[model samples]
Target: MSKTVGVIGGGQLARMMIPAATNLGLTLRVLAEKEGEPAALAVTALGSHLDVEDVLRFAEGVDVVTFDHEHVPQAVLRELVARGVNVQPSPDALQFAQDKLLMRERLAELGVPVPDWARVVSSEQLARFLADHGGRAVLKTARGGYDGKGVRVVRDASDADDWFAAADGEALLVEELVEFRRELAQLVARRPSGELALWPVVESVQRDGVCAEVIAPAPHAAGKVADVAADIATTVAEALGVTGVLAVELFETTDDRLLVNELAMRPHNTGHWSIDGSTTSQFEQHLRAVLDLPLGATGCRDEWSVMVNVLGGPATGAVTDRYDLAFADQPTVKFHFYDKAPRPGRKIGHVTAGGDDLDLTVFSARAAAAFFDN
Candidate 1:
């Protein structure tokens, strides 16, 4: 019987998984909150990812269950596991991805390097933290944060009042803002049978709290930095007992220290360039990891590949009509459009350009993204 893979969220990440699933002769199903969600355009099933009944029904016949996002409740995952559903990145391991504070604590316990942080629940606590950390720090909610949401930079006590009120006086984390030279991401995949694969580290550029572009194999990254990143990613995956793809976002501090920034247990935006640039795309590697299939080579197809996100602009309604013009002039630029309705700052789609020259590839990607700008 052909294997059936059930994905929990219907977004671009899941949408991209379709081609890989088809190539492997595996059936793909998606549990989405609404129709027209990215993966819903191609997935076999459409339902609410958060509804237990919907998820249970969707998983009835699947060989294994994975996810496009970590928003699913741990209780729901545990229940599914209780009923014999094979869920990759099991609930126990997924918790670290779901809650940043938990991930920080766990990583620290494992002797992983990370920025200094503390949990603060009150204005007084925030004040004390600020006093110790040069009166400037970053406050992040323990849950429900992404794309720069649920994060704040506060330099004074009054700035934390709203957070304390909104969280019902619950604890929040305040971390010292380190001066980082640049951000880098390390992608790794772990199989159920204990196999692991790490891809080349990529440099990520962020603008206004959103990822603007990704440059593969990080241009000036020392050989030792790449080796360290891969080792750290592998160690985290093994320590977390994760199955499927895991991405470790890092901070390259000004002093050359690498500090862990975030952990993602599914396909990440940072790895988007792999689709057109690597022999094995992250989507395919994720499927293979979840299915415990032998992993594939992660060799680069070109010396450089750059991915640029097309953030929604005022003329978003014209995206469909503009696709023709967008690609008509640049056939070498690969465009992956999510079937999502555009909203300001939303990730509508992305463009990837691959070539031997890094600067040329980045320029091509930027031009493609600019074509869609209103």
Candidate 2:
């Protein structure tokens, strides 16, 4: 029997899952906000994920419900569970991804290595934390923050006055500004029945708080770094009862210590390279994990896979307009574009190049992505 998986967002992540779902013979359905969404190819219903009626209506007849983004309201998720809908990575586990403050509190209890942080609701509290942490801190709204939004670097308490004023009486999360050598991301998938699979820890490059590039297997990360990253992800998965893909973003500090930075419960930007570089893509693995199917091997298809995102594409034409030049210049590179209108600082697509020669592979990806730059 074929199982139908319903995704709650119609973004590129959901769009990318369509081919994986087809290969696995699973039916893919999406609850999109409107027409022309990237996942419009698989959309079965058009409604707001925030609305109880819309989400409940989309849940009908699907074997399992998942998400493209974590912005879905907890009340809606719990309601789905209460009504007998199988929500993968249940609201209990999903909350850690949704609410940053709760995530910090729980990770601290679990003894997960994280940055020094505090919950502050006022400038006085923020001022004290700043004073303790060298007059500089990273302040973030506990919820609704992604891609650099709702996050601020404060040199003084007054820098966060606006966020505090708009926090809805909620304590925001503030942490010591971490000094790190580089950023790394670990991707893992766990089934409800306890089986788990992990991919190689990869290095991620962020430009203006958005992922711009990824290098698989994280150069020079064979022993302790890889082992620790995998351990951290496994511990979090088992403890939180997470099902489907979990991305743990980490900081490899200048002090040689790895610290947890952020968590995403679904397919993440860092793992996007696996779509063309691994034995099994994260999207395929996610479907398998959510359905309790046997997971696939995560071996690399190449020694080095470099993925560069196409950000802020051409100002006038669509992304496809540049394919003519890109395809000719980098034949070995794999290009993927989401059907989204170009805007400043938006991720419109990505190109991946994999080979034993890291330099050539990196160049191929960069050259291909450069074609799309405005």
RMSD of each: 1.3, 0.7
| TM-score of each model, in listed order | 0.97, 0.99
- Over all chains combined, what TM-score does candidate 2 have? 0.99
lDDT of 2: 0.94
On residues 232-331, what C-alpha lDDT tens digit does candidate 1 reach at each position? 8998999999999999999999999889998999999999999999999999999999999999999899899999999984374667787777788778
Alpha-carbon runs more than 4 Å astray in model 1? 313-317
Clashes of each: 0, 0
Tens-digit per-residue lDDT, 1-374, candidate 2: 78999999999999999999999899999999999999999999999999999999999999999999999999999999999999998999999999999999999999999999999999999999999999999999999999999888999999988888887789999999999999999999999999999999999999889999999989999999999999999999999899999999999999998889899999999999999999999999999998888999999999999999989899888788888998998889999999888998988888899999888888889999999988
lDDT of 2 at 217: 84
Which residue pairs clash in candidate 2? none
